[model samples]
Target: MSEPAVTQHPYYHPQPGTAWEHVDTAGSLLAGPTPLVTLANWQEEPHHVWSFQHMRELMPSQVIDGTDEPRPLPEAPSDLSALEVPVAWAPTVEELLDRTQTDAFLVLHRGAIIDERYVGRMGRRRRHLVMSVTKSIVACVAASLAGDRLLDPDAPVEAYVPELARCGYAGARVRTVLDMRSGVTFRETYLDPDSEVRVMERSMGWAPRNHGDPLGMYPYILTTTAGRPHDGVFDYRSIETDALGWIVERAAGRRMSELISERVWKPIGAFHDAEITADPLGVAIHDGGLSATLRDLGRFGLMLHDHGDVAGRQVLPHWWISDAAAPPVDVREAFAASVNEPVLPGGWYRNQFWFVPGDNGPILLCLGIHGQMVFVEWSTGLVGVKLSTWPLPQDGDKLVATINAFRAIGRTLAREGG
Candidate 1:
């Protein structure tokens, strides 16, 4: 008989000094009594009890292996050892490692899983939350819809979701939302009690405890208001993704979960079922609720690496891939200027993906808060996935170093192959 799985003592808690908080609302809703999950309890081998293969029921994802089985990965160099990257920012990667505390890491290049490691309680199958990486998934859904002609990137948000007409989405175009140029006044401070993110937590059942509050996710989204005009400055707001989800649902005549399954998940041959949390009303939380295993995340990255085509089928229009990967005209300079960090310079965001404009080659990435990334370098056929439960509000220095390391590795492999 198998022994029951147990949780190890967490070394990283969302709130450092708080007690072990637990929320109860049927299950683990985001709001309510349980404090936001932190990475504290992670320990060593005693924690190997948790893995991704056993946690499939907790989230949404579709597993894809072989023409149905696991495909052979490309051969990798014998030793990666540990590469050190100098820090020229506020915090070094080592410093952030001490502060936020990271749990696991995996990197793949040219179809091969090159580097993989675990720390504390993290293991091969443990499903950690992807946070805002969900936004990029939603973006992919939107792009797929555009490819099918069900959506027009230039169309107004009102074209699909009429309810957003009076909200901050009033005059926003689909393109603006994709670029996060929607002038929404969403307060994103994770620690602020009155921030919109907190309110969202309450709405999604993620807040610590808030009884007598509306129980579903959609109502919270419906109530969001517009703060500024569309297409101005770059503001990262989860609400825009929520609005985009609504648009996708309205146009497709199905739930976002089902749409993703049919359009992306199933087609890509994912290795597990990815789950998206919902409000009591059952509307999918498109902003940041999706979760999946690291390997499956790599598969999704591979799908993009193949140019939105899998098995020779043009799953997504080539033009859609081209556009989403293209650098946005308006924000290129601003984004480039913002990349003052040593490792990443001249980075930009387009179609909910991050773009490294002037690196070894053009790089596009799907990044989530707290160290979740699906980085793709098309020029070299490289795709890397890193999933972590690092203490939130990210350590920019560590992220830059890791990205630089991946880029460096990709260049080395490409040159060797040549």
Candidate 2:
């Protein structure tokens, strides 16, 4: 397992019968400056635990500025430590953090923060990479643009990015890519280093350097091949978000950082500036390269909770939020026939958010690799964001456990006066 096993990565596999309570990462760290943590090995366990928070040191990033006059968090702080969460081993709330490799966790009720904690090396002010959670934010912006008639989802990708006419995205619609229903033959298996997705990662500077095939973000998208028909199957391809990012740039005539800062962070009153990694050609890696403070993420969640209103201002369109949260019947049905995962049981993936319907209502979630997540229960106005650095890309049991923990948190907050 030390030599990059095909199915297993190094460090922190939970020992048998203990869940993740007994997992240790002391043996896997390359801590000193002698062994620098480059982008190539940055996603590994111990390295990722640090690199995820500090991507600016390895790659060029653009700032998503926030307002100087920050919107104060509603005064409703509670002891997250006492809020015990259920787990297979014990009822300790810490178990959820330890098992999931959580660096920061925040829970909000009715737009007021109920509980917040920073674990491991996480500090109050430091920004942590939200990974694919960035996709949801990007989706919100894209939907907002479509609402304003600045962009058309039904239009072909080539309409905005005419350069894609010869690429696999020639026939793909903006909405299809947003919903991840594009019939582009791009595999996203993170476990295999040689996979097509990894190739994309290498091009984006997330993986090891290969001087031979150093494709930029645009060129990589152009290399994609046509696959099955666009059948609304809810296929998840990270590159689709990048394509959407480009489409948005073309439609809005502005960079992603500028749009997000102007639209989201400033209006939401984020205290700290967010950042997103960019390729060498200055293309923002919108798929999974956003980093932001935990409080700002909660603020963004509050905006969604209130149907896109932030600090008395409508930062996003209400119709867009509701519609994206509630995907069409055909799209929802497609999810039933698509890939099955523990956390995504019969849920719809529309415009970068996952719709997991419950009896009370639907719980929209945005999950990223290595356990970054934003879980929102719109019915109860409960939102939870967890940033972590789990060693592996996917873990079925961990995914189940994460959703269960979110449910437990929601239920607990509902009964008490949080």
Candidate 3:
């Protein structure tokens, strides 16, 4: 199966070296010798390159432990550097990775690794922050619990977390929150100091809190108010996922990290224990905060591509994967009316996964701020994970280019009988 052909875009020069390769000579580009990374500056420029891979050092975190016997991702090592992507700025796979500040890149086709690269300060053992990609991973828990009748998707958010009865989540169903269609009025503006996202950061202890601000994630969420009616157009709010985390915890009578460990990490036979940043009050930050190694994330993407299969053991619910892969027809209409439609035409958001129209079918995208992506092309049996620190929260061009690069690679490998 061939992918849609791409016109060669004008080539652009990539930076000289990996993100951390350039040292100022005065000292380290970020901090001298041993960089002084703190919660306040960890997400900032130069500091982020190091802090993203070392988040546990700056904050309280809970581990999602992997299994003693890990799943083998045998290597086939194909040269994919010359593969041309569709975007104008970075024409080839190598340049696209460098230009976009990729920390780690891996491609798995039919469950075997075809290509893998680790940039400066990145290694097989180093865990990198995946930002909003964490939402999709955490959602697995909600779906699994629901499959077991431990959770009720049609139930209102307040039913699980009664404390939210007076908040913006009032009357919002669990299904609505999973799809990010809740009427929550929180703004997602990352750079705005006064935006709800940044304020939520303070609550999660990822940023310095202002005086009189909510002390924890739950407290802050309790203050939000509804901006519109429930089941409206997709809003892409991170807090909705956080609320889902809370709901799952309340439903299963377990912590989010524990749930992920039991339901995902171990079943997938991940190589290392993944961790999520915790608030001062010890609640896992489900909106983001997950830092995991590259290969472990690849294993996760592979599991999705295989439709919940983990070495022949069914780990995720079949119904959940089916629903996410081919969502209801109305999902596309909901996404079309959203601001994201311009970037992802003919795409939809369901079961916490993003789907974009593809040559063969819809491509499942688990995206996060700052270039984190896990692209699963089920038709071609391809799964690719790219972890990056783009120095900005979002870049539409980089995001699109990365997707194209992965698609091109998948098409090539499929034709080659990979």
Q: Pick the candidate with the highest TM-score.
A: 3
Looking at model 1, residue 193 earns an lDDT score of 56
Model 1: worst 10 consecutive residues (lDDT sum): 35-44
- Stretches off by above 4 angstroms in model 3 are 1-35
Q: What is the TM-score of each candidate against the true structure?
A: 0.79, 0.90, 0.91
Please, what is the whole-model Cα lDDT of each candidate in the order they appear?
0.65, 0.79, 0.86
Estimate, for each residue in 1-418, the C-alpha lDDT of model 2 and write its tens digit. 2433222234223335542222223323554532345554577766777788888998999999988998888858877664566677536566767767889999888778888889877888999999899999998788778768898988998899999888788888998888888888988888776677888877876654465556678788888877788755777789889889999999999999998898778888899999999987888899998999999998888887888887677778888778877667888877787775335776888778887766488888888988888888866668888888887877767766777777777787777755
In the range 1-418, model 3's lDDT, one tens digit per residue, is 4522322111111135523223233233453444444554567676788888988998999999999999999988898999887867888898999999999999998889999999997999989999999999999888778878998888888888999898988989999999999888988988777789888888879876766779999899999999899888988889989999999999999999999999988999998999999998999999898999999999999888888888789888888988887887777778889999998878899989999878888899999998999999977889999999997788888888898899988888898894
> Top model by lDDT, which number?
3
TM-score winner, 1 or 2: 2
What residue pairs clash in candidate 3, if any at all? none
Per lDDT, what order, best first? 3, 2, 1
Q: Model 2 residue 60 lDDT?
A: 91
Name the runs in model 1 displaced over 4 angstroms.
Answer: 1-77, 84-100, 209-215, 333-345
